[model samples]
Target: MSRLALAIPLLLLALSAHAEIVIGLVANRGVEETRLDWQPIADDLGQLLNQPARVVAVKNEAELLASFQRGEIDVLRGSSKVALSAVEGGKGEIFARLALTGRQTQYRSLLLVRRDGPASLDTLLAHRQQYRYASGNPDSTAGYLIPQYHAFVRNNVLPERFFRSVTVGNAEDNFRALVERRVDVAVSNTDDLPKLAEKYPRDYQQLRVLWQSPPFSYDPLVIRRELPAATRSRIASFFLDYGRNGPDATRAKEKLYWADQLDGFLPATNRQLREVTDLQLYDALFRLALMPELDTSQRQSREKLLYRRYDQLTALLGGAR
Candidate 1:
């Protein structure tokens, strides 16, 4: 090979070395907040991996999945639903999950109101139309999915018709809406409650938890399945070992526990998203339950078919790795 040919190979190798590895961060709260919270971790991962790492903050779960579909993201740390979608799409796999003080495998959705607004869940549901409601995006698990079924559907009160008005936004927006009394009722979850407290201490203090949902799994760390095995191993090890050892180990551990209220990460699999799948099923059930036009026989037929599909999926997921 001539000198030019050899140089060309070397140049290509150098260019590839600097190619950015995009880590998709779902901005459920908003892009700026997501970037602010996750950028440092992305920087550390880049330096450790000897590759250019960039955080591609996407607006919501839909955009995150779209980006992954377009091959614009190499790694992702977001909701379990998105993680499961990636795996189902055959492009990704879960390697780790957040490990907090307790309930590492689960988190809960919450219904909140001003301390004096509703003394109890019964009061709120009894006088449902007297108040405005702030709900999380339709895509939100805690804000919309869980509570929509548990609090609204189960009670036979549709928020859309029951509330005087409804506003859709992120957890923070809904929290602020409640604190400002912009909305009489708001939905939130364990994942965002602590951060909300940090931002609005006195305001947070004025609120009361009206209802809480059953626990579900935390989000997972997912990477493109096509990534080199060595690269995948390094990324998983990085999360699992974070703050566990290093000269700055103590400080790192403290920040992990204090700032994020997370001890570290635990190894996780894509199958852990079973409950989220179940939630989606719950959403389907919500739609079916609300179809008042359907005759009793038709509704019963649909319910049976739906439950059959649900059983098959539960069995399928239970059999997955």
Candidate 2:
């Protein structure tokens, strides 16, 4: 009996070890939104690997970067913007870029307000003193970071000085705040709109889009660099072979909204990642140049920082030789 007991405990431990994997989700929006939308993908991963997958939704860019650096997560799924930054920092690599139906770029942001509330972006800009503004995460592409950088920073509006409030949260929370009359302006994504509208008809009915940004690039499924190459290959193959299991696989495909997502996972190199990374760096530099907060002295300091980064980037891209 004692021998049997020892064997049983060992077996249980083996099973437990095999069943656990920690994943980091980009918490660009709210934790609830990330969990709710990506649960199916997580579940699918678990079933494929015969393991239980745990997802940690990280807030803000710094948190995501830190978690990735510490190897706390096995995979990261985020927009091209976030993925690019992570890649630049050497924390991960793109295993696959997502697509849906005929769409390649899921990056989009719409400036919105309550349907009965706002007339236009121009009118809102003119009376910017009258309303509150909610942003998604400061690092979020379609959410806060990009839109704000484009609007107030590029246009020299200075959000805090002009708007009543500039709050940050998930896209859902931003929209909800608008619906609840807590904020007068919020930014959201086009990819998420149909899904959100279907989920909350009343809220959708009350909102109106003031403007939409041009499409940029799609999100990427990033793989941790520490994982063994064979293991990485196996996981990539598993994800790419989604429909081979008949009905369950088909159902899984629809649930995760990968009907038209890439044909399969592809081997990605650091160079591929550099494409998006460079874009974000330039975008940040542009914002810094246009920032309203910087004085002449501050501008010179900012210019120094920008030029230093530009030089480093050029060297990294093999341009400084």
Who wins the TM-score comparison?
1
lDDT of 1 by residue, 75-165 (tens): 8877777776787777888888887766365789899899888887788888856999998767666677789888887777778989999
lDDT of 2 by residue, 73-121 (tens): 7787665556656766777777765555443444577888887776877
Q: Which stretches of candidate 1 lie over 4 Å from their true place?
A: 1-17, 28-30, 101-105, 254-259, 292-321
* Clash numbers, per candidate: 0, 0
Scored by CA lDDT, what does every candidate get? 0.78, 0.68
Q: Indicate the worst ten consecutive residues by lDDT in candidate 1.
A: 312-321
Error of 2 at 111 (Å): 0.8
Model 1 whole-model lDDT (C-alpha atoms): 0.78
